[model samples]
Target: MSSDLPALILGVLCGTGGTIGYVKTGSVPSLVAGLGVGALYTYSSQRIRNNLPYGIELALLASTVLAGSSVPRAIKTGKPLPQVLSVLAASGLIYYGVKFMQRE
Candidate 1:
C-alpha cells in the first residue's frame, strides 16, 4: 500500500490534535494515543521504507474512530464541518485500505 498525501495530512492533523490534548490535559494516555495513532497513519508512507504491517488498515480504523467520535460532537454543537471532514477522510481511507487489501 502506497502511503498517499491525504493520509499523511490526516495523520498530521491527528498528531497535532494529540499534542494539543497533551498540553491541555497533561495525560499520558492522550499523549500516547495521539502520537501512536498519528504515526500509525502518517509514517506508513515512502519515508518509512518497510512501513508498519497493515498500516493502511490500521489508519483506516483510526480514521473511522475519528469520524465516529466527531459525529456526536457535531450533532450536539450543530457544527457540520468536523463531522463532514472526518466522514470524508474515513471514507477515503476505507476505499484505499480495501484496494490495498484486495491487491495483496
Candidate 2:
C-alpha cells in the first residue's frame, strides 16, 4: 500500500471510530459535528499551503473553536453543530501546521 493510503485509511477509521463511540455513548450529534469540523480543517490547511491569499491559521483556529464549543452542546442537546465545528477547526490546524513545517 502507498504511504498516503495509510493516512487516508487512518483518517477514515478515526472518523468512523469516533462516530461509533459517540453513538454507543449516545453522543451521535457531537461526533457528527466534530467530524465535519475536522474535515474542514484538513481542507483549509491544504489551501493555505497552496498559497491562497488568506490566513489559513486563523480560519483553522476559528473552525476549531466553533467545533470544540459545539461538543458540549451536542452532548447535552444531541446537537451536531459543535462537533462539526471542532473537527473543521482541527483539520485546518493540521493542514497548515504540516505545510508550515514542510516549508524549505
Candidate 3:
C-alpha cells in the first residue's frame, strides 16, 4: 500500500490536469482523468492484492466524471448545464459501478 502513494498522487495530478484542460478547451477531459485514476486505482488495488470487483474502466469513467465537472466551476461559467450534467452522469456511473462491484 505504501508503494501505491506515488500512483495515487499521479492520479490526482492527472485528474487536476484534466480539469485544467477542460477549463481551457471546453472539451471533455475524460481520457486524461481516466488514465490517471485508473493507474492509481489499479496500482493500489494490486498492492493490496484485492480482487477490485469494480473494473478499471468503470473506475476511470467515474473518476473522469468526478474530476471533469470541476472544469466549468473553476472557469466561472454562468451556464450550469454542462457542469451539472457532467457531475450527475459521473455520479450515476460511479453509483451503479459500485453497486455492480458489491454484487460480485
Candidate 4:
C-alpha cells in the first residue's frame, strides 16, 4: 500500500487536471485524462477485491480528484463548491486510507 502512494498521487494530479480542463473548456484531452485515471483506479481496486474493496473508496477517489481538479476552474470562475467538496473528500480519504493501510 505504501509503495502505491506515488502512483495514487500521480493519479490524483492527472485526474485533477483532466477534470478541471474538461469542466472549463469541454476539452477531450482533459476528459480523457480524468477518465483514464478513473479506469485505472477501478481496475486496480477490483483486482484487489478479495481484500474487501468497497465502492466507497473508488467514489471518494474519483470525487476527490474531481474536486481537486476543479480548483483551477474555481479560481478563474470564482466557484467554491468544488473546493469545498475537495476539502471534505480529502478529510474522508485521509482517514479511510489510513485505516485501509493498517489492515492486515
TM-score of each candidate structure, all chains considered together: 0.58, 0.40, 0.34, 0.41
Give the TM-score (vs. native) of candidate 4.
0.41
Query: Which model scores highest in lDDT?
Result: 1
lDDT of 4 at 76: 71
Residue lDDT tens for model 4, 1-104: 53244335545655676688799998997679566765655544453444545534564465466556665666677767546545644654675476556653
Clashes of each: 0, 17, 0, 0
lDDT of 3 at 10: 41
Model 3: how far residue 34 lies from native, Å? 4.6
lDDT of 1 by residue, 1-104 (tens): 54566667777877787787789988776567667767766765433336546656656766766666666767788776556646755665676677577858
Q: Model 1 lDDT vs. the true structure?
A: 0.66
Q: By lDDT, is 1 or 3 better?
A: 1
Candidate 2 per-residue lDDT over residues 1-104, each given as its tens digit = 32123223323544665587687787876477446544544444455446564435544454455545655676678756446534644554575456445652
- The candidate, 2 or 3, that scores higher on TM-score is 2
Better of 3 and 4 by TM-score: 4
Q: After superposition, how far is residue 6 of candidate 4 from its true place, in Å?
A: 20
Off by over 4 Å in 4: 1-25, 52-78, 88-92
Name the runs in model 1 displaced over 4 angstroms. 20-36, 46-52, 84-88, 91-95, 101-104
Q: How large is the C-alpha RMSD of every model relative to the true structure?
A: 4.0, 7.6, 9.5, 8.1
**Model 3: clashing residue pairs?**
none
Flag regions of model 2 displaced more than 4 Å.
1-20, 55-58, 61-104
